[model samples]
Target: MIEWLLLLLPVAAASGWLAGKRSAETVNADSHSQLNSAYFAGLNHLLNEQPDKAIDTLLNALKVDSDTVEPYLALGNLFRRRGEVDRAIRVHQNLIERPYLSSSQRGQALLELGLDYMRAGMLDRAESSFLEVLKRRSHIGITLRQLLDLYQQEKNWHQAIAMAQKLHEESGEATESMIAHFYCELAEQHWAQKKAVETTRFIKQALASDWRCVRATLLQSSLAMEKGDYKRAIRCLRQVERQDPDYLPEILKPLSECYQYLEGQDKFFFWLTEASKRHPGCTSLVLARAAYLQQRGEQKEARYFLIEQLRVYPSVEALQQLLALGVPEDIEAASEPWSLIEEVASRLLKAKLNYVCGFCGFGGKYCYWQCPGCKRWGTVKPLAVGT
Candidate 1:
């Protein structure tokens, strides 16, 4: 806000000069005299704490010129920061209508106006303003970025893909991951509408854009599973562990379903045994192994396995699995362990989120290719093993 005052000082001085100039009768003789008198009167108003009149005296004297637009831009930005959207819009619009503005100056006004529209949730207008900015290509990178975000907000994934590609080309920024997410979004839209062919096509496009996209891999696996192609579904899901181990928990149930459908329980046991070794202390792996042991008529082995796991790395999921088996008989220890562990686990279970943003620490129960809090692509990853 102080910055606004600083900017207004210069604009106010120019306004004062204009006010005095307009009030003068004799241009040659009394112009200079009238200016000095007005300047003193404005200062007297200021010294007397008549700020409102001083401001009025200053603004009523304002001249719209090239030199003045920069400070006005600052003023407009201040209005935006204050949530005065209409005022900010009017300021930028006024600057844009001035015939004296240079091309670059006009672009600056348009960019500011676009931001005003964005802040006010008028996305269509903001999109138009940014697209107009892109026409000159002076600020292509920022324009493309804003357009991309706008498209995403509007769920216009096709437009988002085009804008992201344009941003990549213009700014030399890597946008493969973001492009993949856009394609995945399209896949999800198609899948939700029960358009399997379109969904498969979009999922394939996502993989082509970024093979490392686990969401696309998951969608591909889902599509294959729907077709009763267990082998293909298993292949797609197995790729997830290699592509990014962080998402291994997400594939656990899907992998189990594929193996179950194929009656490959023995193969699953071997795979889980190997996976437990590779990703040791992984919550999902430990929990899966416990259930697997229980299913194999080894309830005692499952109980002991969970006990050892708790000693190595205590977790809420493991505790829940333990309670399902029954509370242990520990009468005299450093503390009564069973209830203590259960209490801690309950708190953690309530507090912990399933997915968290790596960039901004935003957490949610569901996965998002783009972070809901930061609006950043590929930042919201699954919660790692123990979180």
Candidate 2:
């Protein structure tokens, strides 16, 4: 690919530089001839669509000069890109073991080796390698980032938070969003272990880190509901609207439960109506409002609301919910409507992915805190109803 060609450019330049420097030496001609032949052979292999062979030949050619670190680094990267982690690790480790390498070169090799270990699923080794690089204060940002990833993979939220803070300090990049997710992870762990106080503490930490973290708000609401504090739960759920309305659908069912428990259906309906006014044609809000209207014995109003919303932004889920309300009591009339609704609902359900990763466009029926495709945290969101 273009990346491979770019990598080879440096190798070619370095080879030329070495040949020029050795022009006065008695062994210069022989060295130049061998190096030039090998370089051209590698280029020929690459052009012939034999990248694997080219990479192997290039690496072998570079191994002849242990003093040349850049070529080894490039070859190691090539191996990593080709998914040959073991070979990449071998190349980097060999470079690191050389006493002739400068401090910076050694550090670079360690970093690459750590990445190789990570790609090979050798997390423990990768962690230790990165820690060694961090101790030398070399490539601070990259080392911290890799450490954060390792901690996340290991589910060690405490370590992840520490590394994230270090990364923020070193790179001057805001890590609060990721730090908030780390707190959320810790909160989930504590909640699962029935450590209520610790869970609450972690959720508070999450909110302190990033007030816009919808996960923290949702967790807080769930915890409040579990404690029989429906008002607090409803209040917490409502915070999500101001924080990020993109996640409003996630709160609807839980909000309904809180209202039903508190006998505040009318208040809930009022809130839904206000939300629909603000976010007109939002499929979830519109559908919820229609359901509330139908429950109030206003079938005509519910049907009218559905028709208006469908005209603006048609949704299979909205249509299905509308049909559920319009079905008649009489057997014959009900049968036809039910059949039609069933077909539409089936099609809608088939098209619906409950969760989608905003980072990588990966869709699934279940939520993932870390995207499976992009390996990013807090990127997956509930799929919009009309989408």
TM-score of every model? 0.85, 0.82
**Residues 220-320, model 1: lDDT tens digits:** 99999999999999999999989888888999898999999999988987898898888888899899989989889887799999989989988878878
lDDT of 1 at 17: 55
TM-score (C-alpha) between model 2 and the true structure: 0.82
Q: Which stretches of candidate 2 lie over 4 Å from their true place?
A: 1-67, 327-345, 385-387
lDDT of 2 by residue, 70-188 (tens): 76788789879989787688778877877777777878899999999999999999999999998888888889999998998898999999999989888998999899999999999
Q: For candidate 1, which ten residues in a row score worst on lDDT? A: 54-63
User: Per-residue error at 69 for model 2, in Å?
Assistant: 1.1
Q: Kindly give the number of clashing pairs for every candidate.
A: 0, 0
Best by lDDT: 2
Candidate 2 local lDDT, residue 332? 65
CA lDDT scores, all candidates in order:
0.81, 0.83
Give the Cα RMSD of candidate 1.
4.5
What ranges in model 1 sit over 4 Å off?
Answer: 1-11, 14-61, 328-337, 384-387
